[model samples]
Target: MKSVQVFAPATVANVVCGYDILGFAVDAPGDEVTMRLTSTPGIRISKITGDDGRLPLDPAKNTVSASVQHYLNALGQPSLGIDIELHKKMPIGSGLGSSSASTVAGLFAINTLLDNPLTTMDLVPFAMKGEELACGHGHADNVAPALLGGFVLIRSYEPLDIIKLPFPEDMCVAIVYPEVDVPTRDARQIIRSKVQLKDAVTQWGNVAGLVSGLFMKDYALIGRSMVDVLVEPARSILIPDFYQLRELALAQGGIGFGISGSGPSVFALTKDPETAKRITNTLQQHLQKIGIRSLSFVSSVNQQGPVVIG
Candidate 1:
């Protein structure tokens, strides 16, 4: 194939208690990339849409092309002629892995056009280069799930040991993205570097419980384990009416509720699609009532990570 277009799903990272370690993909909101081989040598970002001119077009600076460049360099073809077009279908800075979707889409598209020179897992490190460029942290919480789909746990970052965890089949997610700015870089700065030993112990227990609950298909256990004592306390202040939103989600029968990644966007876990929709509607309504513009989505966990659209 001379050209390929691919779609990558948006992901919810730092799923409450499992900060920098857990994430899962959503179906609807994502990004697309179109890449084609050219006679000219070197990567070129031909165009970018849906970013409102906020994203860079330079191949060296943009996450999509930069990540693709990393993949090419790894294969010892850094001078290969290529052109990329990024289509951002999701809102950037919404705490929903916007950059990851675009980056994954770009990497997947280029790899597919090259006739699959690398496995899906092999593309992850290249994708992380994009994350590093976008947020200054080479964290895999978002990119991992966006590439592999489903729920992922980062067992180790040094060796890049990723564990795909099982989740209840009926689990659905209700996401609400308030149209506010919560840049990942700025949000990461507000996180506490050191935590009390008690909080760390509690967080560890919750992470363990959450993993166990997923494996056991225990909804109640998952709900109880979604508590975050380490990062949320410090970051919740950045979100408007964060506690009130959590209260509303729980009262509406959500299994668990918390900020999606950093702030401005929040999500609730539900057992059924109906509950997911209801929670999203309720959250959007509340945000509207409070004079905050918002976007909401309801999706079952995405099992397919990236797909060739054309």
Candidate 2:
């Protein structure tokens, strides 16, 4: 039997401007899952730790179980047996790629145990299957970064191609998850049915600039490009004091602040750890003042993806 432990870093999706199309990883806050191939020819999954009674363990509902099953099917190993265990170190529905981490860990474990049957590029679509089970939509932006790390720019879903940018060393990302629930499906619905032509043109132009900013390592342009003129307007209604809080974070020496993935959660990018810490305090204090409880995490930009830990 082959056993392996995997860690999939938490990812920030839809970082303000790019909804369902952009995501980046963070190192300190993440989830872990362990997998081992069994002598038998069946599949089983168990949630042993974290998420105090929040997540379902059944193979049909669990993210890890589904990804491994998909991998097995593609490799003509349907009869292959595996036992999976999930450690929900990251909270469920926290918008930190909770489900994506599960899927990535499970898929990576199986591929390694089976002697590296698939490449990371080939495994992306399979990882996306896990997201589909949760949101009824599969956007590779989050999964790709959770598995591959760094910043990802997803150009098209049909062709499934993304460019991995070289991240800056001085970058720091502080993620704030208000202890509130915003269903991914509900958040998606809140976006406008259509966008104005001017907004559409500006949105694409910003996307282009955001993509280019990373290559040039221009933090200000990166922050400026983080503007959202389409989905954010409608979605902001779902989050209490969303606009007011975002403005406060930006004003307090933070590079930028915006919605963190169809969220009640918010995040900001800073040039250094000190700025990140300052932003976290200001954002949390503002949320408390508004009667919204929140948990803040300050993490550096994850430049590397998931890797086996012996």
Tens-place lDDT digits, model 2, residues 117-226? 78876789999999999788888878999888899878789888887877678899887888888888888877777778999889888887777787889988888998
Whole-model Cα lDDT of every candidate shown, in order: 0.92, 0.83
**Stretches of candidate 2 above 4 Å error?**
none
Per-residue lDDT for 288 in model 1? Answer: 92
Structural RMSD, model 2: 1.3
TM-score of each: 0.98, 0.96
- Give the per-residue lDDT digits (tens) of candidate 1, residues 1-310: 2998899999999899999999999887999999999999999998999999999998889999899898999899989999888899999999999999999999999889888999999998999999999999999999999999999999999999998899998899999998988888899999978889999999999999999999999999999999999999888898888999999999999999999888679999999999999998888899899999999999999997999988
Q: Record all residue pairs in model 2 with backbone atoms less than 3 Å apart, i.e. clashing.
A: none
In model 1, the runs with Cα more than 4 Å from the true position are: none
Pairs of residues at least 3 apart in sequence or in different chains that clash in candidate 1 = none
Write down the worst ten-residue block by lDDT for model 1: 256-265
